[model samples]
Target: MLLFQKLYSRIYKYSKMLFLLQIIVIVLTFISLDHEAIAELPYTSVVLPVHKHTDASKPLYSAEVMTSFIDWQYMRENFLIDIDATIIWHDCSLLWNKNQGDCPTNSCNYPVTCEEYPCTDIRTSSSYKNRYCPPKTNWSTLPVWGLCTCPVNVVNPVTVSCVQVSLNYDNFRFNESNGRNVYTGWDDVYPHAACAPSSSLQSFPANVTGVLALSSSPYALAGYLHKPLKRVLGLCLPSTLSTPGVLFYGSTPYYLLPHSDVDVRSYLSYTPLIKHQNSFGYFIGVNSIVIKKRAVNIPTNATTKISTTEPYTILRTDIYNPVVRRFLKVTKRIPPAKPFPPFGVCFSTSTKGTQVGLRVPDIEFSFPDGKQWTTSTANSIKQVTKDVACLALVDGGAASEPAIIIGTFQMEDNFLVLDLEKSAFGFSSSLLRKKTSCSNFNLTLVNSYV
Candidate 1:
């Protein structure tokens, strides 16, 4: 047993000596390696001097390079070289402890979690797979959104101006037709036809002496008369006869009444052969008439009777007298004016017997010479001869046959006042009644001289 003990002690002592030898050797080797590494490093001092920079002018080592060097040194000395030593050098500063949680071992170390770092969970954190880094701050510096939404295309707007005139013939015709017939000596003509202008006959031929009336009525008294006159002149007279002369009582012979604002009142009468269409035929016989102005009220103070004077002009002379004269000259006395052998008067009753009543066509008269007047300019009368000289030439005479004057006539005293209120408020028939009632008039004169 003693021998065994002695042997164990020797072995223990030998082991201790060997351990000391190993420690000395390790220290020497470490010193030698460190010295060699230092010697092997390029001389920053020499490089500085070559570049003509002093040690103070040389750039210092960067923190990243220093940290990398220190980490490599620690890993080599503590882990790779010392195989038996369990001590490990860990860079806790490099590891993220807040994101990775506590280190797995006491010797293990981790980095801290920065607020900018995108950590999934500190308790059970994960490594960044995409290596994405969050922005250091919020994006409050950006400009406002949605500022450019309007389209850049489309068009714009523009302006313009336009003038017009209207006339009423009913009033004009009525007024003219109702004028006094001084030559005929009829205060009002018989059958009242002489008192009204015939719509069928227009102008009397130039040679015949007769009273001519001008109307402002729209029924076209002159135009109506003209239509039949065209036929009559063609049938009854030679083509060589000159166009008939025209006379106007208040204005120039050619002056036609304007239709606007004229008062119209008249009635119509005719035989059965005179339809509305053929009614105009009735105006043919008396185209040539001396249009004269007769004083409505004869003044006792006047030295001379108001003779033909200003504002009264003869428009045309009657051609019917010459035709009759020619016929009488040939036959020794006037022949009947109708139903000649060649063309018998073909009377049509289809629209016949339609009669229209009307007032005299309105006349504008010159205020009687040297006399004061209270009425409107339209109502004043000037002498017919002074106003128009053409009246002096016409030859007045008796009718060849007892001529039947066909025209509309109205009551000399009654004037139509259009009751607009009645027109608007009353029944439609009331208006029709007024229209019909105002359309015609009739008067009879015996042995009336033309």
Candidate 2:
């Protein structure tokens, strides 16, 4: 009787163990199924707001972007994004924490193969050597490089040094959008492969933990979108740090909310994008420069690059002298104030103010397509102090490659689009001219919709 009772007890214990194991398998399968479902979502495009971090503690000179990342447990965080048009890699320094509790995500499993889209192109790129040069740090610590697990190298725009790190596939969520408007309440999840620095980043804002690469590379942040999405990147920079702007990836007809009748795309003027042999920066052919409708003699080799890093438009000395001279000639009646350190020309703020900006002559650039992009006082004049305002143009030593660089201050409240598929650039001279601004995109409406 004692032997029979012991056999029954063993049988019951084994049955319970088998049931528990089955439950675990079912749960694991469900998680896999959930991720697969998200991957197959039909959304084709995404949009994100670009804001200046209002928090004084995290003062970043560059524009701030917002993005969401999801973990295995489905927790998400809107990480601060830095826009980099010159670099190719999307970097995330937020995962530097060694503690698993901080991330709570599945560890990186997929090793970026050299044969992959970006890796292959990066290795063969003209700028590959200069762009991906590793820092002069410890090289012995690098892992044995191989096809299954080689690290992807990237240059830090801030430090101008490079670091190699492995790529990890993380779930990212974005508000899906049609070209014109966004679907405010919907959150679409997509897997994006990003490299996380093994160490903390230096010289970056405290809250800025990631970079959104807007370069023309196939691996730009928008390039990660599903195959069906159009390869277009649109930007509207806000005039003030307190107001938010918008960044979108998709076909155009972008509408700033509350004014849905007007498509910002309608304001865009097209110019062919000039491709540089070894540079990732967006270059455009500038046929001529005109100040106040009077043409300035610019070198035939002169080109213009659109940049977010430079705060003011930079002109080579030769170009600067001629352009500045012409501008002064046009506005000679306006009394010149003490020259600002970086800016050669300055005027008293006592000058009459227009709705757009301080009354000043316009600077225009004629493109190869025979079209011109005009900048009036709104973009050309920067008020330094209550007493003085300066021309927003800087001198970029005569030897600089791209003769003119259009910077952030000049881009404010202007709509710019880079259509990769078309290899074309589009510009909306100024949104304020249309009685609207980049900040007109109503975040309040977005919040209510959410």
TM-score of each: 0.12, 0.75
Per-residue alpha-carbon lDDT of candidate 1 for residues 1-450, written as tens digits (9 for 90 to 100): 999999999999999999999999999999999878645532111000000101221111100001112322321110011101111111122222333464443223221122222111211222211112221212211113312111110000000000000011111111121221112121111110111112211221211111211111112222233111111110000011122111112210111123212222222111111111211121111212121232233122211111111111221114333333332333332122233221221111122344222112222112233212111111211112221111111222243111222101111111212111121100011112233211122112223232
lDDT of all predictions, in order shown?
0.20, 0.66
- Give residue 133's error in model 2 in angstroms: 3.3
lDDT of 2 by residue, 1-450 (tens): 999999999999999999999999999999889778655644435777676543432223333333333453333332333334333333443233243254454432234554566545555555645634652222122234423433555665456566665554444556666545556444443333455563535455545555566776655666566655678888887877777787777774677866778888889999988888766668888878888778876677787888765668899998899888888888898778899868989987664663223588778988867899989789999888777889988888969767888887788889998888898989999888888888876443243133
Show the lowest summed lDDT stretch of 10 residues, model 1: 154-163
True-vs-predicted CA distance for residue 225, candidate 2, Å: 1.2
Candidate 2 C-alpha error for residue 48, in Å: 0.4
Candidate 2 segments exceeding 4 Å error: 1-44, 53-124, 131-149, 159-165, 184-200, 350-357, 443-450
Clash count of each predicted structure: 98, 0
